[model samples]
Target: MCTVCGCGTSHDHDHGHDHAHGHSHGELHFGHGPAGAQVAGMSQARLIEIETDILSKNDRFAAANRQVLQARGAFAVNLVSSPGSGKTTLLCKTIEALGDQPLAVIEGDQQTANDAERIRATGAQAVQINTGKGCHLDAHMVGHAMEHLDIAPGSVLFIENVGNLVCPAGFDLGEDCKVAVLSVTEGEDKPLKYPDMFTVSKLALLNKTDLAPHCDVDLDLYEANLRRVNPGIEVLRLSARTGEGMREWIAWLRGNLGRKVPQAAE
Candidate 1:
């Protein structure tokens, strides 16, 4: 098993990641040693080597998956968010809102198929990959999932990654961009806390607008914090529950699709 995300004894499977859509390509999981890191006699270099090796293999799979998706003319978007950031709700909203676009979902979860079931409810083709104790989804799983899923060319492919803010940031599943989601119930300083995840993300979605007034969140500070970590990050505030800012979010999604995704009628 790989040391980083608990990848040693694994089986290939697919499950909904909610936003992670956590799927198992060949045996990928993103968790540490139970509760902590195993750092007794291992040197930093050894740990780095193990990480590098694991990432290297994953990157290769990601690249291959990218090529296949791109060849089919699909634009892949990787959604990264902490668990319960309303990722699945946002996805469900997006699927219904898009209306006519060709969209496929790859759900990555530790074991449940719930996310995929929800996406399928929207009449979109979806596959679920069960990570089996994995905290994040890897490229090998995605590549294999593409073979099983019937996503069309010129479509938008959404990879709902395994739902950890930390581990998923490091693995690239050949996605065009990483979209990060933040909830109002969380602290505004989350960007500062998870700098790497925010730094690598191209866009940030500030979700749960319906609860903003009731919560003690500082929206201004939140945006400022995001900028502090990623100077060029673009942010959109929306509530998947109420459909607020859905147009903007949809437009952004279209804009990312090489400016080809159709605009939904208001």
Candidate 2:
């Protein structure tokens, strides 16, 4: 039982054969302790302590990962959003458009290796992190991933976090910035409803603009809501499938990538 976060902990550390975060997840049972005695006996102070400890542990891991990347002068971006927000497609397009500049990806999901496979298809080395029953990717998991991947100096590492809005918002994975991908098809009120995500995000990608005309999506209302939640958040109207607004995304990536800029030819 994890006194911190109450999410429990696994110290098996099975990293020999599997991918990053080789955790032996424990089965979750409802009600705290035997016959729910612990839940009834637990004080509010204990719960607060747990939360603080959990976050602090995660932050320690995040800090170490940040130091490593900064030392190498590499850029790390965490891409987060709800499921089916075209994040994978956007990454594929970004990788292809960037054109071979030492790019690697860490794909996080609960199940299959499909997303990582899709990313590798675009001509970049990629690895998948399967977080079974886990809604968010924490810093510890990402740190493990960095050990296996070749994220060298002046390279770009994109960590595609698990599809989640609430949990991922609070967890810091040692990223330089969080890029929120919100699809127009998801609805205009998402930003207002999930304000925490927008607040944490440095940039919001208004994806699927190609389908905006077909759907009754209000771009203005979305803009207002997003700005209300994150006053200074940069936004780009884009469509990953159609090759629209991709140049701007590349420019953003280049500006954030290390000291030496990537050559136009490669």
Candidate 3:
């Protein structure tokens, strides 16, 4: 089992592993570890040690992936969100808006090649990575996917991470920046609920705005909560279905493109 997310390490099984046995409280409580996750028959200290080891190995691969992108002068962004946040739709629209500018997509899902096919239909190069039981895409997986892609110099690579808000936040995939996508239908308090995801993201897109009025969502509150979680995160309200705010979204992408990602401090 993965110490970080408590899911099976193999990708051929279900993504989330639900350990039925909870604490003696008759409910599941995962507060047993510094890592905030618990696995049966594992001590908190042991879990922390294993998680550190996993992340350290992942970081090495991430550094290598970053070096490869930097050498090609390519910019990469890891798009993360929960399922049904319209992340794939946003990517397809972004691909169309960027018409001729070099672009490629890395689609990460627990199963199926649907999203990758959607990206390819936009006439952009795409690679699909299916992590069957893995909760999120790791640096090693992204590194392998890059090998199958013909990423152009100065191109923009959008890595659409598996639909997950928790696990993906802790794993860096060597992207220049992380972008958080939240649907208005998902509630305005999402930023507060998933603080780590918003905190690590460079930009937050409040997607599916076309349904905001019908959904009775408070867009202002969402922006306020996002700012509360990440003071410097750029927030944009856009509906990929309606093409609302896409120009600004596209412009933001262009502005960030070609900028070198800084190396992590030791």
Best-matching candidate per lDDT: 3
TM-score of candidate 1 against the unseen true structure: 0.84
After superposition of all CA atoms, the RMSD between model 2 and the true structure is 9.9
Please count the clashing residue pairs in each candidate, in the order shown.
30, 0, 0
Write one digit per residue (lDDT tens) for candidate 3, span 104-126: 89999989999999988888889
Cα lDDT, model 2, residue 96: 88
RMSD of each: 9.9, 9.9, 5.1
Instruction: Give stretches of model 1 more than 4 Å off.
Output: 1-38, 259-266
Model 1 lowest lDDT segment of ten: 12-21
lDDT of each: 0.82, 0.82, 0.85
Off by over 4 Å in 2: 1-5, 9-44, 258-266
lDDT per residue as tens, model 1, 108-127: 99988999999899899999
lDDT of 2 by residue, 105-184 (tens): 99999999999999988878888999987788889999999998998678898999999887788788888899999999
